[model samples]
Target: MEKVMMILAAFVLTSTSRPPEHKYVYVDELKNWTEAQRFCRQTYTDLATLESQQDVEALSDMATSVRKTSELAWIGLYDDVNSWRWSTSDSDFYQHEEMDFNNWQAGKPNNVWLGLFRDSWKWVEGKNFSFRFWNEGNNEPGNNGKEECAAAHFGRSGQWEDWPCDQHKAFVCYSELCGNASLPGRKYFFVGELKTWTEAQSHCREHYGNLAVMENMEDVGTLNNMAASLGFTSTAWIGLYDDVNSWRWSVSEYDLDQHQENKFTNWQPSEPNNDAGRESCIEMFANGSWNDITCSKLQGSICSEVRDSDVKFTFINVDMNWTQAQSYCRNHYTDLARVRNMTDIQKIQTLIPAGQNVWIGFHRPFWMWVDGSRFSFSYWRSSEPSGSGEHCASADLGNSGQWENWDCDGQRPFICYNVVCGNSTLPTREYIIVDELKTWTEAQRYCRENHKDLATITNMEDVRMLNDLATGRTSQAWIGLHEDVNSWRWSMSDQYQNQFRNWAAGQPNNKFGRESCGALSADGSWYDVSCSQTLHTVCFNVCGTNPTFYYSSTKRSWTEAQSFCREHYRDLAGVRHLSDNKVIQGLVQRAAWMGLYRDSWKWADGGNSSFRNWNRDEPNHNGKEGCAAANFGNAGKWEDWSCGEKKAFVCYAAVQSKHLVKLQLEFPSSLTEDDSAMMEELLIKLKQKLKDDGVKGDVKVSWRKRPDGKILHKPKKKKDEL
Candidate 1:
């Protein structure tokens, strides 16, 4: 019969708690945006989503606490320009013909469709036409030659006539009016983990709502406040990106409105003819007239500053490309100047030197949020979102949380958020040794029937624990560790694979193909040997931190040593690095047994831990040298040899414990007993409060439901013969 041992367990549940409206978690890991998103989904909620000022504040506070004042982290935001929508969706917003109205920028909306060249002359403003008054006597629009453009001949009763497109003639321009609006709520977190934009999006979608989306100035202000609290600044991913469509002002406010009079243009005759396809920026001639030009051209620029109802224009003599000029103006002034009317244009004209062109505030539109939120709110730093290919957005904490566009592949830390569910706790284990002599299989059976199972050592902490338990006990024992020759890995599984190694030269020569166990030499090198060899062993009790080594004079087979180590210590010793090998080498005077053996490298409890400390170029499987061992003579490097060789061995184990705390309850009348979700929220708050109060360890909080399925009840009113 198997003997089962019972350990102490305790816990407590209470009422009366309040959790934050939004919970944000800052992960410190570094990964691409997609990986970060996946981690967030698995570990917490999702990438931090900021819908309101409160959310931003929450994230800011968290960031300050972590002391990650200066760094960029991925958020749940991205760009999806392909999903375009009209600025206004109201059916009544446009009349029949108005719906087809278009005012493409110069040289845009490429003309690729088949159409009659001579008869297809269209309005420059993209307007439809039905009436025509041609210079009939002059055979106007005759397409007599290469006349691709039309001109109104004042000399002929104002009738239209075809003319060469390149001819320099006076032209007409127009303007229209536009307006802006706003929306609202959510929470945020400041993750310190780094990831790419796409990765961050995945993480946020899986774990939380989505990347932070700011829909109004209120949100921007809140985000700014959050960054201000940090006393330092850095950049982080946000939920805005460019889609490369539409056209708008750099300030984001003065967009094309509904009224025609509000729209204004002063393009010189046939001026905005889009010389090439590259003209995406606007430039003003010295005469205060406007024309479309390539954004890459260097030129002076005008900046406008708004004070109350008055606007002031300042000219910057520095020559730079459109984007650069925009940035400079933003950093030093309000923004590229906006000419609202002829008066404003005249004001700007006075600021310009003769015959000098300057950049203005107009630009092609392409920015949008990752979550499909309304693109109403914006808080961009001066000249941000300037680069053509930078379609991802990040918040510069150093700049009061202002936003900037960046490449999607650039790595950065991220923030994640989740709903408060309850408390959190971590699981642990303990180890013990049993004096016995048995084969590897028999030892495993014994441990399973007795203690939890054969000891499974993971980190140096486990080694330390085994060292503590080995004091005064038999120096030799069996442990629960083995290896699989086919797939090289440890039985306990984790995210990290064995990356560090120190191997002996030309090692692991399986003499007779029977070697399946590992041993250590006095000089700290490794070798495989037959499992039947008998060896002494070292054992440990607790798990955590640094590890110590011990040696015994007794000898046992590889299998016997493994069993002895398991009984006396945690398991066979697992040297993780040069330091660990050095420590073990100092203890052994000759050869000894270790935990590493060959099979499929698995823990006795069937853990999938991928931590392996091997010697360089070892386990070469030389002549079927399947077993592994440490050779102290070779700087504690590893080698492959037969398992049948006799040597001493080491063992290790982990220490485990649990605690429970009980508490009384109180609740506001508004909260009912059936509000389980609210109860969960309160529990989460309590957990956070504990953390705030310096409670450490893998502590978890939860409501221990009673047998009657109730965790809270109103206390019976006390009656005293009233």
Candidate 2:
């Protein structure tokens, strides 16, 4: 089916307006990222740039007409050293920008190579160096190649310096033309200068409209046309990039701030430096300004909604984490109230009691849920979760369900909760102890085989139950809490459901620089390795009776294996427990990536659910890339998977029912027509006879569709063949 673009008319209903009339179009073609970008720009907007949840929803809605939920496409979102942007200032795409204005922290943008921030610098040829604000004491661009990019540091009066291109820093891109266009009117030029991603970003900012922002396939086609015109083929830089999930309104209406002036944010001078790497969620001060905090921090949640033409605000008095609070608000009312403008903010302010901090729907792009649950809460311990790499969270049952942020390998008593049981009829809370301590993944496996899963404590009662279970234990035990270091979510869950993680020791290292995928290692541990590696695959099948896992002898890449398993059985294996891992372990000996890959945390279905369960060490690798998998060795804790690696995977399917019903009848001997054809006629007459006796509703007489696509057919057979 061909994708059609629709201009949804705006209407007034609630307290705030929609963002803008973003024209969304979908391209039904297979092309790499660059080719897709070119096509979108020439035809419509750039490769369907998605800046807001509304934008994502709009594009998803448009694509649903031509694509399945599991199908993938090229959106204008690629991880080019973490700089995410759109082709123009379109309201929809701007949802990814944390703050529109520039307010850099002091000594910021000192582009550090590999993990070292230095006063370094280097000038790429043909790139504009016109803008300069050197500091007084050490303003020179450092000689180290690591500090190769520049940033506007608030510390040095907003001066600039060169920094590493891969440090996951914030950047500003300028498009000479910021207007949203339907067709290709402006010409995009290909600058051949060898520049870093940031330098190219700078060059584009200085030159033609910031590195050719493509809006749709037409725009992409224009670029492709440009490439064809110039015969240039190597990868040229574009404006779409990002290292972090930026902040957007919790209430994701398109016209919430159409004028863009509503984006005026009040922040403490030098606020949102992301103090630690984990500070991605937003917090509003009493004065209505916003600051970034870790999602695990405990705080009150502020929610707002439009009811009966009047915007109402509700301040939940509970102290819960961001995800938990999100679940609470969604379970009771609308999603965490999205504050679109000052009017909404003021409404929220009047409701919030003095000195009470709360979480709104506002959040950065990453740190989403695996089951696509609401990411509306955070409960991090103060001054905790201080790490530059990918970070995950764990709940501290010993501390009133308060959570602590730690590295991926931090060993602690993890928890898990189960909603579905294999045998039990009703929901039950059965917390079990494993005297034999193991990694988070191992512990998860142990709990699943014996019990439902690792324990999940949703409220104080559940936490108290855990406390009672751990009363006499000397040290902390593992629970079913997990978060993504990459902030990526599973494809099946779409970022709005609960997740349980179990990683191995020193695992998810993202070793050798290209480890964006995850693999289940021997002994049930998980590690982040390159996605291109080939290994055995695992498949899962959900037949009658119970879910069964299978190991395949054929080896293929993650994509191929996923395709094979999906075609033959089900999609790649999604191991939910320790029993799952042990079952898979029995099948294979070496390592392989599962169907679980990472997509930074996001909620699906707008605000579908808000439940999460993870082991302590999670969301590793700077919360960037990698899929998720359960490691049975660590109690089925989750880990990341690289999509390209060929690993044994698992697939599942629903039981197929046979239409032919067998009957043990008595008077058949008197009928005398025992041949198969005669039997068929007799069965038809028998069905009609039964219907005559009032055997209606699901007792209709119909022939089963044959394997050759025919409803009425019978195979001829010899006596021996029959």
Candidate 3:
């Protein structure tokens, strides 16, 4: 059954001298699950936990009274899956079974379309130990009666399967020390005789540590080498065995460590169905609703903190979003309340007089940055992000940087950040200001071409920079923050990789479940959609050089634009400077194409900073497209694009900043006209004279029109003067 898992600790009121009531702090902040936990632990008790229906009612009442929107305050309840340990008994390997809890970060062991296959299998390895390459369908472990031994199919995607023992087939052996190499040797050899799984295990145990325990892809590669060397083809047994119902919670039993069984079960209807055998983690919505979900999806979390004082509870009365509340509690009180026994539950009932929802530290998994950064910060608007289709996030310049959820397909303005070049100075950071209303992907391409890739904000400093840039702007703009949901990457190769994403409401629907692209919508939100659809794009180029962008009215596929760019100039335009965006934005009116496309959401700079700004349910991956674009019409947010779509595109050329300045010179009327003509000749002499003067920098001069919009020329003699 999928029930919200929580860590319980009892605090009983020993003396009647103490007040019969506990204080429940209602902090209103917007933070992800983990951040709230830290806040609660540091400031107050852990997130409020409910021991009974009465406790739930009390918390609900307080939440209903205080909450501004339907946003649920975090509670001390979460899923405890992915906490498997290895059979080897070394706890280190499984310490973080929940390390990259999001399935996108570390694909889970379940039956899903993972590329192409749906097989049910169990890891004999500890609940913490999860690593597999199983074959499709019935070839998986526990597939047939009496099929208990596991083997690797070397030729076909290196997947694994179970087979009956006593079937004579080749086998691979594992050794912590093999062939006297001292190294944990995986020297596999084709043991010619077909033996049952048990027999193979015994033989390998005698010769080495055990049958080849394939730990990672590297081990599989080693097996491939062994198979090639021996030329033995057919099924080969390895050490893996099946213990089908071996699921466990990641929560430490030491909160009573000895108790492994879940004492409580509160599952929603049709929940814990183990959909596709992947829904192992538990979660609860506001209203005390409980359900099971895959560990990979992203959600707000709940955390606990022990209090040194005698007070069993503290109620924060501030009204912040979940993230904000978590930040407040962490700074002042402990984390969200962590209710343990019925005593604390009763105390909570007496503490809060109203209903309100707040944030606790609970990790509900979702799309994660491939760089593996923490999901700590969030800034969501009220009653925002309400949809199941797909969503992305956007920041409203009109609303003091407040953000709202949006659709990836919708076009909008966006923001992009740059890596600090020389030092930690404001001038060292480059920002691209793409004014053209292009799709998020196009803006990203423009930014990459002129300045850096889309802006990648690191902390509040970056956000401030964006706000400062948006001071007089009415429409919000696009930033280099977006998510593909399947994975996150950057468009440019020279920029830093920061995990900062902004999605919109129910965006990224991935309508048809194949939309792997991203876009920016109006309201500065992000969305996902098929890349083939055409939209406006932004482009940028090197300042002081020839025009950076080359607009072609003839629409072409993204691939074709890339080809055209490579052939004529450089690969599609890359924006590396903020000024460059402003320069290029004036060139296009409608949505066009840029070089930016979705490739597992990796950053071009490769610096892993996990910061996401998703609007709401987003990155739906509809239409089987895998590209990205920037939407300038909608405030420059982001959305997905298709590589094959034919759209107007922007290309750029790289050039260094020119130090020379253009000046218009007029000869004094006193001088003869011949002197002005001789001025050109005199300039040659002046150049030599300056060289003799030993200037540190080179000086180059060019002709320019006068302030009156006319080229410099000898003033015509006034007729009266003549």
Assess candidate 2 and give its TM-score to the true structure: 0.25
Could you tell me how far off, in angstroms, the CA of residue 620 lies in candidate 1 after the best superposition? Answer: 2.8
Native-referenced Cα lDDT, model 3: 0.41
How far residue 698's Cα lies from its native spot in candidate 2, in Å, is: 52
Per-residue lDDT over 666-695 for candidate 3, one digit per residue giving the tens place of the 0 to 100 score: 656676534557766756766776678884
Choose 1 or 2, whichever is better by lDDT.
1
List where candidate 1 sits over 4 angstroms from the true fold: 1-427, 431-481, 485-600, 627-641, 646-654, 658-722
- Model 2 is weakest, by summed lDDT over 10 consecutive residues, at 1-10
Weakest 10 consecutive residues of candidate 3 by summed lDDT: 1-10
List, residue by residue over 134-193, the lDDT tens digit for candidate 2: 333464456255343344332222334444333333222111212232211333445555
Local distance difference test scores for all models: 0.56, 0.47, 0.41
Task: RMSD for all candidates, in order, please.
Answer: 26.8, 27.8, 30.3
